[model samples]
Target: MEKNELKTTDSDNGHSPSETEKHLEHGVPVDAVNLPDPDEGLSEEERKRIDRALLWKLDLRLIPWLSLLYLMSFLDRTNIGNAKIDGLQEDLNMSNNQYNATLTIFFISYSVFEPLTQVLLKRFRPSVFLPVIMILWGICMTCMGLVHNFSGLMAARWFLGLTEAGLFPGVNYYLSCWYRRSEFGVRAAIFFSAAALAGSFGGLLAAAIVNMDGVGGKPGWAWIFILEGLATVVVATLSFWMARSCSTEKMDLQLTICQVHDFPDEAKFLSEDDRRRVIRRLKLDQQSSAEHEEFKLDYLWASLKDWKTYTGMMIYMGVDGALYAFSLFLPTIVQQMGYKSIHAQLLSVPPYAVAAVVTIFIGFVADRTRMRGYCNMVMSLFGIVGFAMLLGSGSPHVQYAGTFLGAMGIYPCIPNTISWTANNVEGVYKRGISLGFVIGWGNLNGIVSSNIYRAEDKPRYKPGHAVVLAYEAIFLLGGSVLQHVLLRRENAKRRNGERNNWVEGKTEAEIEKLGDKRPDFLYTL
Candidate 1:
């Protein structure tokens, strides 16, 4: 069989060569040089075959492992709530306020250290950086089993938060590096569904683990921490050999790796044509040949200055506040509604399971339609209705159904928001910094969530539910709408030849230095 020929063209999105040349001569920045139109070189049948095979291979290789890693990270982080019901607070003689303080302290460290860790991840190789943090946090989680007092548990949790902060943002930046803007939603959704799955399975796991309370002279809650932490260590060790780092080549190409900074352009796992097609598609989508750009403080500054970054942070904060509150308190709320401890744990599973499925479906549709903001807005309505039901009703079954609406609504919005910001942002360092800052700032809401559901509020927790509901409304109706409008206006400006002053007469290197402010870059709505 003959290999396909690769073709490149100077025209981009209907811009003529003379027009581009005229713009360049007039000190106006032009988009990518020589964008490859890969589809023109192949028969439609061949293109379809390659697309299906390549995407399938990429999805199989990337999504499952990343999802599993995140699932474990979430499980370890939030399992304390499950353990609290299993007697962690009582055993440590912690008051309700002190217990809330412990949760708040973790987010304090997590929010503070997130950007720093992300910067370090960019400095180092992900294969090394990701697994190393996992191991460290796994150790910290294990140490939680040994803490006999509130102070000891607090110290352990603080360290765990520091270590775990990098994974979520790091994964978002990682996915953006490999996939095009349109392809990112589903991948991010699949990866984020792990958190929902963790909520579901964590409850079931706790229910079972608590049964071993009297085993080995340790409490069941202690065993829960120890066993889950040990499992994380084992997975982290395996990930050292399993997880692949971002490609080092100027054009992004997917390849599996076992160590730091190893990205072979022609790997044995893929055909030569397959590799070329992947690189071509990514280059055209990004409108640049470079995937791994040099890190600069200016990129970080640019991201900080970008209004989208702050708006994105606000959206995440609203959703995260509700998510953490519900995840941590659902079991307690269920128990308060006249259920036994074990029964509450079991009941928590169904809502999360339903959420996991809904999140994936929403992600698939969002990617297909390329309408992240719209999807997020609709999903948030589910949560608002759920909260309204809880607030307006006195019936137990009705409130139980409310949990399903809440989970389905809130969990799917997380991945959509993440991919929305990731899609609109340009440049590797800028995206990384934006993601880190957004996630870090978003976590500040954890402090609010922890305090809102006070022990005094007990069963109905109207104040906590109301606060979360209001935040969700702001995110869905206000923040997302504003962001979409801003993005559309910016994209129109780019399309209409309204150039940024900094980009004029600059080389590709100089233009890239402006990060997302490059005149040719278009923001995704």
Candidate 2:
């Protein structure tokens, strides 16, 4: 209630009294960004309008551009496969082993760089940081066309990985800055479905681009890399200009889109009252008020100590193992079943199309129901049953149908699992690292998926099918159920005031720094 009293309370809590604590009273937090009550005296109608406008503007401004950014990332990553079929190996005189080595180098670079890039994501302006990396990778992709030997191509792939590593988890963290937990799943699904879009349509795009053969004295395969890489560069360039708000860059006093996007406190497009409304809702939703905490080394390692983060990663690994293995071998498996090479490629399209549609539907439902954990379990069962049918049945029809179930299972499970972790984690810095670690490390499941389907095991690869089935059923489904029970129990403990030690004898500002560990902060189930 008084300045002298505030310092005495904070000193007892073993916290030094500072400027931030001076304004904190008994139970009220002084916002990191000082403001009056954001919604005070507003009519119910006005509050509703501010909420609606914020979501609509963000959905328009953020989702589509992010989807395209991710689309390009997926295209550049996978287009190497298309290049090989278009005579990349023949032109470069590359051995099969050398070609395989090129692919492996990229993954190594990409996986290792993920955790570090998330730190940079927190430090820098995202508009500047994200597009800069896109340009770097696009240049790397373009250089592949000019390479004349195996070593040249390998070098380009490695750089491409280093540059592209940040886009996936970075976008997930970026969206969290603007969207509430309830709104995240569908946007993530839409953003992730860009991979499905790339898988389904990238071949067609490559086919058209490669037709530029001899137009610039390069082979068709070389043109594929050259043109696609240039396209990524062009789109990334336009994103900078689009950073000017539709509300108009000329609007007085507010920062440009790029500057405001650094944090909601700086939103150029939102009216002053509306912007504070956005920040207030987020603080309320998280049940913590440590807005704009300075970056600290402790934030990065905090996620490492949280068991929930590892459980999320292990569960995600189960989904990634099944997803990648199926994607890699689907065409070959179909070819072995007596279809022509081209015919199998065409058949592969339906599975991806089915996956893309189902993944979007799952996101909308997960947000509305808040049953994300149950959704993951249900989806994993689809994969388990799909793999079971493939292993047990002799019918081509049954095996063919298994592909659909597998696609449906793994695609939707990915977004649900990702958003599940994103939903529960609190604090910007900790979330940045948590998502980066969970996604970056989970993708290392690629190693297992890559190996399980040995060449000798083709034409109903029983070993691969069995291995993936166990991963999905045991890890994804089981982990989802386990987290649900644990989180529910923890929520009850907090609800019953059994966790009051966390808040006792602490200044409100010190308590605000607790993030998700605050007793009032319940884990999402």
Q: Which has the greatest TM-score?
A: 1
Candidate 2 matches the true fold with a TM-score of 0.86
lDDT of each: 0.79, 0.75
Task: For residues 1-525, write the lDDT of model 1, one tens digit per residue.
Answer: 001111112456664333223334233233333434446668989888878888886676667778888999999989988998888999999999999988998899999988887678766767779899999999999999989999999999999999999999988787776677778888898899999999999999999999998898899999999999999999888777554533334323333432222121333345566556665565556423224567778877889889999999988998988898899888888888899979989999999999999999998998888778888888989999998887777789999999999998799999899998888777767888888988888887888888888889877888988998898898655788888788778767665555545455666666545555655556666
Residue pairs with colliding backbones in model 2 are none
Measured on C-alpha atoms, candidate 1 has an lDDT of 0.79
Each prediction's TM-score against the native? 0.88, 0.86
Model 1 — TM-score against the truth?
Answer: 0.88
lDDT of 2 by residue, 1-525 (tens): 000122233355665544333434443445523455567788999878868877887776677778888888887877776666557878899876676677667777887888888878767767678888888999998998889999999999999989998888888887877777888899899988887777667656755666677887898878878887998888776665556433544634222332224556665666776667777766646523224668888887789998888889888888977877777666656666777634555666777788889899999988888888888988888888888887777677899898889888888988888888888888878888998888887676765665676547767789988998988988888888888888879777765556656677777667767777766566778
Candidate 2 overall lDDT versus native: 0.75
